[model samples]
Each structure stands twice: as structure tokens, then as C-alpha cells.
Target: MAPNFSPDAVWAQCCEKLRAELPEQQYNTWIRPLPPADVQRDGDTTVLNVRVPNRFILDWIRTQYSTRLEAILASVSDGPVRLDISMAARPAMARPAAPSMMPPNAQGPHSLGTMGTALPPNALAARASGNYQGGINPLPPSAGPHTVVLSEQGEHPHNVVGLHGGQRRNGHPQVMGLNPGLTFDNLVPGRANQMARTAALHVAGAPGHMYNPLFIYGGVGLGKTHLMNAVGNALLADKPDARILYLHAEQFISDVVKNYQRKTFDELKAKYHSLDLLLIDDVQFFAGKDRTQEEFFNAFEALLAKKAHIIMTSDTYPKGLANIDERLTSRFDAGLTVAIEPPELEMRVAILIKKADQEGIAMPEDVAFFVAKNVRANVRELEGALRKVLAFARFSHKEITITLAREALKDLLSIQNRQISVENIQKTVADFYKIKVADMYSKKRPASIARPRQIAMYLAKELTQKSLPEIGELFGGRDHTTVLHAVRKIGGERAKDTELNQQLHVLEQTLKG
Candidate 1:
């Protein structure tokens, strides 16, 4: 029964308001065609409750439209109407007799859909039983025999041969192939990346069902992308047709720009939603680009609706995506997050030996260690260093000894070494000694500053090629002998004092890493 305030009329007005309130792309993604959730008058404030599909969508709405929502409600309602943004429940799965104790992953405030029926009863039961593991899914075909559809009721995994027949794309994704050998199996795991690798394996084995939004973060050259590809490969291996779509946040941005430019927004949405498995890399790039962030927020919800598995890799958690909308950040936090660290020395050595053997190069133990120790812990850099040494050895007909290896790749280390100028050394020492750079050269006779000043000089000598007089000049025109004395004292202390030695060792490692 329609109240004196017509529900359909209210929804129509709400839709119109949404169009006026949001950007065209956003309105189309979140509001167009989707009817308004039931509107109920609660007290003086009619609390217009809008059921959002997922927290990501809900968050995006709140961030970009919360204020507009209140105004929209104000226009439709008798007076000011408070907005109750919520994740609509699956109507097919009846509300539990008692309150359904949400699983750890579903405890978030947002739901999977705008209306309470996006998830089917079967999917809810599957989640509730905790017995069945949602296995792999096939890649989408173009209007093929078995097409997965998401509704609010019960979900049943459909197969081809008779059901919805979606066809496979002949050649849509024109992206180049990533390194075939960089899959998860090839990664040499150690303490630094053991946890991250394990999580990725779990995701690869169990797509959307295991980790709806699996997050892997680490510095550049870390195996973030490698683990992502490994999972993609594993998923593809289990289900060859698994529509595995991989793109960086930058590429996503490009797509957004193209779609917006060409007015092919529908095509863009279709292209992304069609993937059975979505793998996003360098998600951090979405932080600064608002339009790209909005596009992704929609793609995420649509895929989740179809039970499509999503794996994202980044240098920071969604929450840390600066310049990104808070709601988007919150949605990213809805999933399990794991981080990868730079490979440890042992891991690096194993990786090097593995690569060397693969390349038919017998890298000596010392050479391997030297390569592993000096180059950044990233596998790509490790491989590059190995290739350089092998090329030099192959062309010049010389074994890859420490000297030869050093000569072959002095350029890389040279720039890296040159970065730590005298000022940098002074600053690094001052930071370590809890002093200021001014104090290093200050006429102040305090031993506190003088001791640190000495270490800086010593590090400058070892790390940089600055002459003694040059080093002396950098230290406020001190005599060469004084600079030399500082270096010798710190060097001596490094040898005798374990703590001091450890600190020096750590500093040396930092300069190299």
C-alpha cells in the first residue's frame, strides 16, 4: 500500500535528485535503474534508508553524496530527513531466527547490495554452513551457455551446456603478457615474504570465496605483482576459462579516461564486469585520481555481486591511499590484508641461484651472495644483475668473480652510492646520534656531537669517493687529520663495541639496501 507519500514517487524523485547530485558516471553506476530502497518515516526525521550493494559503494555514496542525500530527502520528505545508509541484505536468505552472527569477513557495516536481495539464499547458506568451499569460476564467454547472474535470493553455481551461454572473447584484452616465469611457484619464500605468499596461495586455491578482497602490499621490487600473477595463473590453471583480468591502477585510470572521453561508459562497465577473476596491481595509484577511484569502486561491487574473485596489490592498505575517498578506503579494509617485505639475504641468494640455474649460468657461491647482497631484494633487479654479469662473462670470456661482477655492474651501485653525499652522511650520522647536522661541524666541543661527527666522516670515506681534504672541508673546514682521527676512532669502536658494531652494520646495510 502506498502511503500518502507515494513510495514510487519518492523513489523517482530520489533518482532524479541522485542524477542532479552525482557525477554522470557515478550516478549511472550506483543510481541509474536501481530503484530506491523502501522509505519509512521514523519520528520527526523520516530516516530515508538507502540499501547500498557493498560497503565500497555505500562509502562512495556517503563521501560524494551524503550531503546531497540529506538535501534530496529534504525535498521529498515533509522536513529534514536523516539518511540511514546500509548494505541491503539478501531477501532470499530470510533473516535468521536470531540475529545472524556475521562471519569475520562480513562484520563490516556495509552490505553487498543496495536492496536486501542481491545475494541468493544458497550463497548465504553456503556462507553460514562454513562447510563448503566456493571453488573456481569460469571466465565469461560472450552470451554463452552458462552465465553467472547475481540476485538477492538463493545463488546456485551454474555450468554451461544448457544454462546461460556466455561466449569467450576472441581477442579483447590487447595487453601484453607479463613475465611467464614470474609466477608464485618461482618465488623463493623466506621470513620476509612467507606470510604474503601463503595468503596468495590460499586466494589462488579459493577465489572469491576465500578472500573477497585480498590485499597484498609492499615496496617496489617486492614480489607484490609476482604473487598476484601467480594467483592469477593458479586460478587459470584450475579453471582455464577463468576470465583473469589484470591491470594496474594507472591502467584503470586510462580506461576511465577513455570511457569518459568516448562516452563508452557502458562498454567500460561491461568489459570490467565480464571478468571472472579481477587482479588489480599498484592500487595505490588510485589514491590521487578521483575519477579512476570511482570507476574501480563500482567495478568492485558489480564483480562481488557475481561472486567474482578480486585480488589487489599495493604499497599501502586502502586506508593509506592518500587522496582517495575515505569510503573507498573503508571498503578496501573490508578484506584480509597481508604485506610482503623485501626478500631477506637468504631468500635473495636462493632466488639468485634459482635464476642462475634457469639461465644456464653457474654463478659461484660468493658471486651469488655478492649479487644477492648488493642489489635490491626485488627479483627483477636480481635477474638484471645476474644477466649483466653473465653477459660480461659470456662476451669477455671471464668468470664472474667479485671483481668482474663489480666491474660489470658498477654503474647501478655508483648512482646508489653517490646519493649518500657528505651532507647525507652527516644527516644520517646526526639522526643516529640524536644530534643535528650543524652539530657535526659546530665549534661546540661537546663529545655528544663530536662522536657522531666522527662516524659521519668515516661512512663518507667508505661509501663515497670524497678525498680526505674534501671530507675535511665538508666538516666546517676542519683539518684533514681531525677528520681522519674521527674515521679511525669510529672504525676502531665498530670493531670492539658489539652495539656500536651492530649499529654500523645496520647503517651499512641501509646504504646498500
Candidate 2:
């Protein structure tokens, strides 16, 4: 028999259970936006309708979390209710009150406090309008001198100041420059970034205590920004009123320039110096800018004086930063520094699969390896290739297969396969001969330069698809006859002269490598 229950009460109880069971990101991504549409009965069977924003979310929840949700609902209603999670034709209106100005993304943060003070799903992103309209579970009136400023485009949080040169009265600083989606749970750890992730976790757990100035450096798209955001999100979860600020070094420089223009140095100092945590991305931009460096140095000293946590990211290690102030570089080196290396082949394949899972895409293992093997640059390129494949599949209305991926990334794969370029060949030949790379293309007729130049021309013909004319153009615009002669001479000598054969073989391997 179907148990009689109020739909609203049953859903409320289910949400409480799911929030406790799932990770915060999982809760936010799958469950938080779900609004109960209706409950009905088909003979003895009971059904619960929950509205979703799009087909992807509906399908994801159906496949991944349906069984778990069914169990939770069964426990709450004393029997299983057929969960009818569906995509709404239009936005539903039967939701809790929210600001008129919704965030760009339909799914935003819900300030539903803890278990005892759970609110409706519509309560999500109530702070979307730059105001924290907490109806049930409200924050304090003030958190020291920091003001709760809603982040813009997940960029830096604006530090709102009060009229009395003190804290704002509206709310405490719940500033979050971190993306809600980038959490520790979603981050896959491997040998490449394990130490960085571990240190980030430590800093998140005890900010300003252990790693006062945690510095993370790595190449592009290696998850440096993601780890920093994870730390910021963890800190926010721990202390809702924590004053957190995140921005790029360019943004910091812009702030300094603007403050100087407006003659508002005092306000700028207050905004940056009183933070519980400050995060800066791509600090390599801070190099060669004296005024910006001076301003940041002052703010850095001030924040340190107050024991505020500071985390920074860069493309290079601290000492590698050229033209920067020595004092600033010294401060950067004082704290813990961690580097995230490029992921290995296995790890790349793992990242592709994990990203596909997050996007609710059913990717075959072979197809993922195909994509991973081709795009070996960094994590960014791997994801970009995967995105292209997904887009092609969606547009062509086909499932992702090895053949489909090849067709999707045909141009990208061509570029990756031709790794040996004429310029690289020139450099390799010149370096092997212990001569400057310019000597390969120079008009010098010395045997040292001429032999290496001829070998480079031969490599261009063998290792690349360039025609003789094109090869000639690359070598200081010589005629195609000169290129053909060089290739013929090298071919004949490679078989007759043992020394030349060994050198040609070594040069070929170097060019390919």
C-alpha cells in the first residue's frame, strides 16, 4: 500500500539525508537545484516528480544517483516512491523566494545553513544580487572589518567597505573567488600533483597556521588554479564569515593603478591587508613592474603582520622571476613552495575518463586513450580535445567511438604527428655540430656550417613532408636544386663513409626525439 505523506515534508527530509551522505560538490551539483514538482499515485505505486533545469542534469541524476535517492526516499516515506526526475519545459515558479537578478549559471550556491536549518532549493544563489538574503539561517551582522562581497564571474571578490571606514552592516565577508565546482573531491590525485594537493589540503585545514604563504608553481593547465580554489572553498566551508579574496596578479596591479589614479590608497590598503586569506594567480606577471611590486610588498607585509594566509601561483619557480624586486622575491621564497609536474600517460588517460564522468559523457576506455595519446601537451589540451569530440558527437548525433574521435580531431592529430619541424631540425643539426643555430641558415661556406646545413636540408626532406622548393626557402631562400643536391650528396655519403653514416643516424634520431 502507498503511504500517505506530504510531498513538501518528504522532500525536505530526503534533502537532509542526501546532504549528509554526499560530498558538498555532489550535493550542490545534483541535489541542491532539484525542486519538488508534485506527488501522485498510479494504482498502488507512488511517484515523486522533481524538476531539473536541463536534459543533461536529468539524465545524470537518473543514471548516477537514482538508486541512492530511491533508498533515501523509501526510508523517509516508509516505502519507495518512483522518482520521476524530469526536465522542465520552462522554469518552475513554485520555489522559495530569490533575488530578481539570478547568476549567469542557473545552478548557484544555496545558503541553507546546516541540517537543522535546511531551506528550499530555490534558496540557492540568493546572494546572486550581491546581497545575502538569508531568510532562515542568516550570518552575523559583521565579521571584523571584512564585508561579504559576491564574486563576479568567479573572479576576485570585491571588498565592500563601510561609510565609517569600518565593516559593512549588511553581512560578513563570505567572499569566494573559488569556483563551486572545483573541490577536492573532483580533483584526481596522481604522482604529478599529489604533493601540491596534500599541501593545499593542509593549508585549507589550518590556514595561516602551517603554510602562511603557500606558493604553487607549475606549467599551464596543470591544475594549479583548481587546487588553490579547492583550498579557498574548504576555508569558506569551515568559516562562513572568513574574509577571502582571490585575483590574478594583473588584477592586483590594476587595483594599484586605480587607487593611485583616485588617490584612495588608504581604502586599498584596508581592503587587502585585513583578509583572512588572499589568493593570487599567475604571479609571473608581477615581474618587471616596480610600482605594482612596491604596492604588493606593502600589502604583503601588512597581511603577514595580522597572520593572514596568502597563497600564490606562478608559471615558474620564485627565483626564475626576472626583473622583480629582490625583497618581494625573498618573501615569496620564505614560505612553502610546491610544483605540479606534467601528468604521465596513465594519469592523462585517467584524467580524461574522470572529466568524462563529471560531464556525464559515456566514454569508452579505448576512445579515451586515443584522445589522451594524441594530446600529450598538458591537461588543458587533453580536455579541449575531449570537448571537441563531445561537440562533434552531439552535432552529428552519434556516440563517441574511436573512429568518431579520429574524425573529430583530424586537424589536431595532424599537427601533433608532425612534431619535427624544419626549424627544430636546423637547431638539432647545428647543436650536434657544436655550432650556432643561425649558422645553418647563414651564407657561411666553412665545412663546419655547410655540412650541418646540408644534413638539416636532408632531414627536412626525410623527416618532413616539405617539398624541395619549400625546404630551400627555409634555408635562407636557396633554389630547390641546392636542396636536391644536398639530399643526394648526404644519401650517397651516408652509405660509403662510416663516420658520416653514424652522424646521419644520430641526427635522424635527434630530430625525431
Candidate 3:
């Protein structure tokens, strides 16, 4: 006789295991919010249907937790287990109730008098004409100064002087230019962004606490902006009334110019100095602008003084920035500084599959790998390549496959192959480290030369299809074991050494370009 199988019980056990295995924040953010799985039996297979709120969560779970979940399910069950993840259907909106026909003295379901509330004549007219805002109550002129209170369940109520000012349609304050679509739920975590992501999470959970004035620097299209937006969105979700703003450094410059022309510097101070959080991007643009830097420094000092958190991003680190005032740069570096490196191979593969899944097309793992291998620059390039392949498949009416992907991305692949070679890698690495290209093929073993040589070997192995022996032959006739040892050593060190990883990322980007 077989034992009874309860899907909810099994899933609860799995959750207990996951909560123990994962960090509290990660489990709560990703796994804890998930509803119980719906299990069904098909032949000899036990299928567990896992529903997520959005494709971002779906992709994240599929990449990070699906294997572990399946294993846990199998161990707890009596037979084979399969996990299927999909987005849950959105709930239907509730219809509004009809107006009551009761007498003025009678208390009905929609009667505000029963709750000791009375609307102004204009407010009643506005509501009847569908012109009233959800959360704002229009008061008569004689009513004088009125305060509106907004509160979520079990949270302190927020008082607003003018509820009609800058409120969103849903009654919440405008999230200060934050894109609601960008949140921690959608931003995929990987080794490339592990440090930066961790810092962002810390700041998000407790803004104005740790990592205050957090600085995130990275190359373009490397998800720096996405991470910043994610932090802002997370904070906004927790505190609906919190004042937050996200803007480009150029926007600050524009504001400076505008206010300078009008001689309204006080207005500028009033705007930026009152924020609970500020998310700024591309501060490199402030390099040559004296007035912008001065104004930004003022705002930065004010924000820090008031214990408001500030997050900024740029193409390079603070010290690497040129033509910027030392005072401002010092303030920028005063707090925690972190770098977001280019995604590694595994991360690139995960990003490709997740994005492809988001398009409602099931991309085979092999095809995704093929695309990921070829498009190695950044997320933007990977997305562009995926778009081309998807468009090609649709245009040709063919299923997506490795061959089809190759044909679709033939031009990109051709350019990449032509530009990136062992010789190119050797030259790029040599140039970046201020070494000689000839040293790549030399027998010299100086630390300075040997380190770059090992890096070249790693890049050659990673970028090309050359066998270990062939790479050794190209590297001054070294043995295959020596090449393998160099590759392993550098690869391992890259994981542990942040500086070395960043250098490798720069070299890879240069070579790919």
C-alpha cells in the first residue's frame, strides 16, 4: 500500500528547508512570498505547479531554486517529482456597489453619516460627476485648513497638508520618478553583481542607515541603473509617503542652469534638500560643470546631515573620475563604494534564458548557451542578440534551435569571430596592463609578465576554441599542463580578488569591442 501524499504538507516542508538554507532576506524576498504548489499526478510523474506573481520572479526561481525545489520534493515524496513554474492569473477587479434608495434619515451600507463623516456639497457633486480623486476630500472654503490622513494596515498614518498635490491615481504619493516595474523581484542576482546587489539590498531595507550615500560604479548597460531603481522602488513600497527622487546627473545640470539664469538658487535647495532618498545616475557628466558640482555638493551635504540616503552611479569609480572637483569626489567616496562587474558566463546564460522566457517563447538551453557565448559584452548586447534571433525565428516561421540561432546571429557572430582572437586577446591584455605583446609569447617568468601571460591564457581559452595544447604552443611553446595550471589559478583568483576580476572584466570588454 502507498502512503498518502499531501502537496501542501510537502511544500511546507520544502519551505522549512529553504528558509534554513537561504538567507533571511533572500528567502523572504523570493521564496517566502510564493503560494503553495498545486500538485497533480500524471502516469508515474508527480507534477508540482508553482505560480509566481510575474515573469521576473518566475525566471529567478527557475534559475536559482528550481533544482533544489525539485530535489526536496522528490526526497519527501514516494515517486518521481516535477516542478512547473508559471505566472499566476491576476485577480478580477471588484465591481462598485450601487447607490442606496434609502431615506436621508436611514443608515444604509454606503452611508457616511453612520461613520461620523460628512462630505461638502462640492465634494458630493464631484463624486456624483466622477471628478473626485480617490483619497482627497474636497472641503468648502469656510472649512479652512484641513488635514488628510493616509495609512496602511498596522502602520502609522501619514498627514498631508494638500492631499490633491502630486498624489498618484491610486492615492499613494508619486514614487519620485521611480519605475514601478523595476524592483528587486526582477533584478537577477549573480556573481558579477553580488557585492553591489548586497549593498543595495542593505540600503533598501534600512535607508539612511548602512551604506549611506552608496556609490555604484560600472560600465554602460551593466545593470547599474537597474539596481539603483530597484533600491528606490523597494523603499517606496515600504514607505508610501517617503519622499524619493531618481534623476540623471544631466538633469541636475539642467536644473542648475535654469535656476542660475533665474537666480533662484533657493528653489534648487528647496527641491533637493528635502528628499528622503535620492537616486542619481552618470555623475561622470558633472565632471566639467563647476556650478552643478557645487550645487550637488550642497545637496549631498544637506541630505547626509538630515540622514537621508543617497545612491549614485557612474561609469568609473570616484578616483578614476577626471575633471571633477576633489571636494565633491571626496564626498562621493566618503560612504561605501562598490563596483558592478560584467556578468560572468553562467550569469550571462541565466540572463539569456530568463529574458527569452519573458518573451513567452521557450528557448532551448543549448540555443540560449549558443547566444550567450557569442554575445559577451553586457546585458544590452545580450538582449539585442536575443531580439534578433527571436525576430528571425518569427520572420522565417521556424522553431528556435542552435542552427537557427547561428543563422539569425551570423552577422554578429562573424564580427565577433573576426575581432576577438588569441592574438587580439594577447594584444588587448598587454595594452591594458601596459606590457608588451611579445611577452605573451616569451619564456620570461617575472611576476609582472607571468601574471599578464596567465591572464592571456585564460582569455584565450575562454574566448577561443583552441585546445589546451594549442594555447600552450601559442604561448612560447609551454606545456599543456602549464597552460591548464595558469587558467585554473587565474580563474580561481578572479573569484576571490575583486580588483583582478574588475581588470579581467575591462579586458574582456575591450577585446569584445
TM-score for every candidate vs. truth?
0.56, 0.53, 0.64
- Model 2 alpha-carbon drift over 4 Å, by segment: 1-176, 418-513
Worst 10-residue lDDT window, candidate 2: 145-154
Model 1 misplaced stretches (Cα beyond 4 Å):
1-167, 170-179, 413-423, 429-435, 438-513
Q: What pairs collide in candidate 2?
A: none
By TM-score, highest first, what's the ranking?
3, 1, 2
lDDT of 2 by residue, 1-513 (tens): 444667777788989898987645456546765776477876665677676543323334554566667667677775545666654444434542121111213322321122212122332222221232333212222222211111112222223222211223234333635566666776777656755765566456546644457788876778888888777777776666678776778878888899999999987887787788888898889888898898999988787766677899988767778888888877786555667766655678898899988889888999988887566556887889989999999999998999999999988757545878999998888888799988877799988689889999987887677999999999999999999999999977664443454466456545545
**Residue 135 lDDT in model 1?**
19
**What is the lDDT of every predicted structure here?**
0.62, 0.67, 0.71
Best by TM-score: 3
Q: 295 in model 2: Cα distance from truth in Å?
A: 1.5
lDDT of 3 at 506: 76
Which residue pairs in model 3 clash with each other?
none
